[model samples]
Target: MKSKPVLTILHRLAILAYVVFALFPLFWLLKVSVTPNDLLYSEGVRMWPSRTSFDHYAFVIAHSAFPTFFKNSLIVAGSTAVTVTILASLAGYALSRFNFKAKYWIVALMLITQMFPLVMLVAPIFKMLSPLGLTNSLTGLVIVYTAFNVPFATFLMQSFFDGIPKDLEEAAMIDGATQFVAFRQIILPLTLPGIAATLGFVFTAAWSELLFALMLISGNDSSTFPVGLLTFVSKFSVDFGQMMAAGVLALIPACLFFLLIQRYLVQGLTAGAVKG
Candidate 1:
């Protein structure tokens, strides 16, 4: 009885500490975004600047190429997430339910793909895409992002599928449902948490991806948010104000995305929480 209260206190403290640690950077980004350019260097890392302004936000929205970049990023990340999730759902179901020839080799190949440094494949990927008129296009980026993310997303989806029982499928079949119908109507709805989790993972990854976007896309017309940040840097100085404002803006869609799916996210992530 005496130890319970103490343990509770410690657990709460630990959670508080973790929350602060995770959100500190976002707070700083918001802080910097509102701080005036003149106060940035003079302020000397103060928690709150003496003065604040939304000038940076205004400039980034109206006077910069950031809106175009934002649009392009939304397109690439959204397309990649949707495509990867659909493919992963089917592949993961097959991997979970069906035992087939070369299954071990297929899984091994996926693991191998993850182990190699992304840098090693950059040159080869660029060479392959360029010949097909894929370079400097959002379509190229989506295809690349989907390819790299499918193996991991499939594995993630498979974990959720494994947790569900096959009895449901058998029962549905007994009721005159076909395999595809059962999967489409029954298993898919039950796997909402998994789909939500996978969408969040793939969306976040593609949204923040810079290297492949940089290598595959060249023109501002095709640039994503991360690559478009380069416009703030010129020969000498970095525009911290507009850059931070843009950074803050970039975080909105991701936050809204998780917000929309957080119901399933929490269920999927914490499903085994109460396990014995």
Candidate 2:
């Protein structure tokens, strides 16, 4: 059956409406970030304020702890993303290809790790890290983030590996390449999309995590951008301008990281490797 032109136009309109509806808040945030404070309340809910200024941006960068927060968040998130991706790729490939004793149990255990709520583990994790003096440290946060992200990342990577073929590595091995060499050369190249996806996933998770950072790190020095965003709220009122400005700034690194990896994020690196 052929669809009507009017129905297709309506369908496109529906999608466009949903997209704009979902993105409206972000658009508002960007608008308010540049809006002058004097006009914040006086403007009475206008889109694209009549006047805009970079004063809040300047203040957040120069007068606040936003820079430190940005740096700490970057380091923790970048480290966690890289570490988790490395571990995940290796484990995922193993899960996809190897048939060893207890493989089922190992996969089940990793899945089990994903089942529990992270909130439930906070107390025990804090107690464990406290004795080692790691609670207040950025390294501690990275370690925790990596631990949480790895299982999911492993699963993500495993799906990608499963999508790829066994024949490519088998061929490489037949050509005298070791398993590691074959993986590093042939398999890894095919899994670039999975790697980019995992890295972006882990990085964004660690970047915006606030509850754990708030619970673990008490000092201003080690606070991540999410936690620092909270500091903009005083006992009486929130500094909307500065907070919005900081939020906009915090989005930059994630945007940049994705932009850097987007080239390899295209699907189907393994299309021709196997027969249908």
Candidate 3:
């Protein structure tokens, strides 16, 4: 009984430490967002401000081009996520189940594609897209982001598909359903968790990707939120509060996305799709 209490105390301490570690940055962001410009340096690194205001958030949302950047980021991220997930699901399922000549070589090539550093390919990608007049376009960003994210997403989705049994689809086939019908009506439903995971992964990756966005997109019209964040910096000083406020604001979609999918993200999407 005494040991149990000691263990409980230790568990509580661990949880407390983790919470502080994880939440401290967010707390700081909120604190700095509210800290007025005058007191920013004057306060000299104190926890909690002597005063607080909504001015930074107000300015960021109103006076800044952040909204447009935000919209563009959303379009790119959302499009990339949906496209990559759909492609990954189909490709992953194929990788997981079907076998044909050159399958090994095809998988090897896909793996090779992932091995090359993205930075090395950026110029070539730009050149290819430039001739097609896709540069500075949201569609171009989507295509690029989808291509980059799909290989990883495919591995992610293939693992999920592997976790499911091939028997389910076989049973459906025996019941006279076509393979695509079995995939749609049977296997797909059970892969919701994996789908949600892939969407979240790809969305978050594209949402924050800076290099490609910065390289391919030129004007504010095509800027993503990450590139827009750079506008807060001038040749002189950085606007810390406004930047933090923008950072906070940029987190909304990703958080809302996870919240929307959290229920389906429950761990058992494939529970009945297989047996031990």
lDDT of each: 0.93, 0.93, 0.92
The residue-by-residue lDDT of candidate 2 on 1-276, one tens digit each, is 999999999999999999999998888889989999999999797878899999999999999999999999999999999999999999999999999999999888888999998899999999999999999999999999998898889999999999887888889999999999999999898999999999999999999998899999998999999999999999999999999999999989999999999988987666777786
Worst 10 residues of 2 by lDDT: 267-276
lDDT of 1 at 217: 90
Q: Which residue pairs show backbone clashes in model 3?
A: none
Clashing pairs in 1: none
Q: What is the lDDT ranking, best to worst?
A: 1, 2, 3
How many angstroms is residue 210 displaced in model 2 relative to the true structure, after the best TM-score fit?
A: 0.9
| TM-score of each candidate structure, all chains considered together | 0.95, 0.96, 0.94
Candidate 2 residues lying further than 4 Å off, grouped into runs, are 1-4
In terms of lDDT, the poorest run of 10 residues in model 1 is: 267-276
Order the numbered candidates by TM-score, best leading: 2, 1, 3
lDDT of 3: 0.92
Across 1-276, the per-residue lDDT of candidate 3 in tens digits comes to: 356888899999999999999999998988898899999999788999999988999999999999999999999999999999999999999999988788899788888999988899999999999999999999999999988888889989999889888788889999999999999998888889999999999999999999999999999999999999999998999999999999999999999999999987899666544565
> Which residues of candidate 1, in runs, are more than 4 Å off?
1-3, 268-276
Q: Provide the RMSD of all predictions against the true structure, rounded to 1 decimal.
A: 2.5, 1.4, 2.0
